[model samples]
Target: MRKKHEAPLDTLNSYLPVGAYHTVMQYLGHYKVHLTITKERRSVLGDYRFAVHGKNHRISVNGNLNAFAFLITLLHELAHLIAFEKYGNRIASHGKEWKLVYGEILQQFLLLDLFPPDIANEIKTTMRSPAAGSCAEDGLIRVLRKYDRKGDVKKLVEEIDVNGLFRTDDGRIFKRGDQLRKRIRCLEIKTGKIYLFSPVYEVTPVSHP
Candidate 1:
């Protein structure tokens, strides 16, 4: 069977409103960040990797990702760029710096109220709840349901949590990547580092009709 071709960035670019696109560019400039988005298998829903040779950066979003997921992934990667630019190597991978930026960006995105009422409600609920193991399953469900809904899918886009998925362990909350990608609260004996894993599933963002 022939391999299916993924949609190009330019094709996706046409779907984005000029205002939103420019806003993203402005935010990128504020952090002196440069990134290229491509269709690839990121370890998670989205992946942000820095370039080794240049000031350039790269963000990979799954080729089959829906519009909402794509937008959220872009924002999530932006949070990483902002955190790295501001804190350098001082902050933990999914530490306070990331949380601050994530919250701020989330707030900005929500202010636009671009999501559907139901999905927006879910986003608000998830934001308020502590990141616990129980929430991931339900959160994933809510995100997926909103994505699959037809008509005015852009309304559901705001519901995607781009910054990163959160998970709870023993009442303590940690963002995805704090541990391994599957086992929660997995410990590394040598480094004494904590790992937050990503939820093992794929969700498509809802498309606007």
Candidate 2:
């Protein structure tokens, strides 16, 4: 068990960047939350686990996320922690209470100039009233995408050209096809099977033209 005043973020400096460490440290201290960074999650960017079975309240975020994304994901899960603190999980996940807490947390960063101007402005607009699904907010995504670490980054559905060959991190290759509602139709190059991929799905375009 951590000492009563132990700096929680100290345990995370290896996973978090210098720019984001201070804010997250402060948040952890305030909430007395236990944080863990696991391998990149397949389903969600972050998750919050309520205290149970004598475990300390815990929050976990993917390890590979860029700094901005890491911060927002942390805050999103932290907002859940705060919501549970105020009103147990009896309320809906994204109800008005959760929205209020989410917005409140973002407001602190905006007011403190923690983020770049563009991102801060985008967050300000989106947090006027937090959306039910954090992933569905375009303004926030636009700002966060700008900060994505640019090394051989994968393309999302919108970035993939028709007939292009794209591969996932796990090396599954697919050919971009037509759009189908919210998902884009794709053909797995090796399997020769059609699949629908989320627009936000990350993929590296392997063959162009």
Candidate 3:
């Protein structure tokens, strides 16, 4: 029997979502880093690892992300590695130093060819005081989710009817309530505490459609 050979892991774009393959390939080429596409989780989307303890630098992003989201998350983690190289974690994880590096990297993608006007504009503002999570930037996530698969971004307010129960993307269940500005004040079914949630927070309705 003849032995079979396999393609290089770097050549396999099956780990990435559609439209992200070429961009990610270029990113890996530029950084000389290891990329890992992990199973989707409810809380965290992606994370990064520094070249420490004799291990090569590695970056992991959740599987099935839309192109824009994947790019943003990838760049976000890449900034951490870049910042660590410069500052050596002397500053806070999201302090001024890291923010500077993250901002500089994010600016590289701010163009009509890379993203739409709405997304680019929002990214400009987000870089001013970059949030810890991409989901924290309402406008940015909104635009990114448009590029996601259907049913990936069900609006909390719309998906779960008023007074209905739903689970947040982060795994918290809440009983829907009245609106408060752009967010809704819902009661956490577990904690019994009222929490304000964005009307557009990605969620899955607990009850049937």
TM-score of every candidate: 0.56, 0.79, 0.77
- Candidate 3 residue pairs in backbone clash: none
What TM-score number comes out for model 2? 0.79
Best by lDDT: 2
lDDT for each residue of candidate 2 in 104-187, tens digit (9 for 90 to 100): 988876666667888777788878777665444656776677777777466677688888888876778888899888789999
Candidate 3 lDDT, tens digit per residue, 1-209? 21222324665465444455676567666667777775546556777777778767887777667767777888888888788888886767878888899898777666325776777788898899998874468778777777777855366464567899888666778889988777888888888999888776777778631
Name the weakest run of 10 consecutive residues (lDDT summed) in model 1.
Answer: 167-176
Candidate 1's error at 199, in angstroms? Answer: 8.6
Rank the models by TM-score, top first. Answer: 2, 3, 1
| Cα misplacement distance, residue 41 of candidate 1 (Å) | 1.9
Residue 104: error of model 3 in Å? 0.9
Please give the distance, in angstroms, between residue 77's alpha carbon in candidate 2 and its true position after superposition.
0.5
Model 1, 1-99: lDDT tens digits are 212243353465653433356566677556555444454442445566654566566554544455555565667677676788788856775677866
Clashes of each: 13, 0, 0
- Misplaced by over 4 Å in model 3 are 1-31, 157-161, 169-173, 180-183, 189-193, 198-200
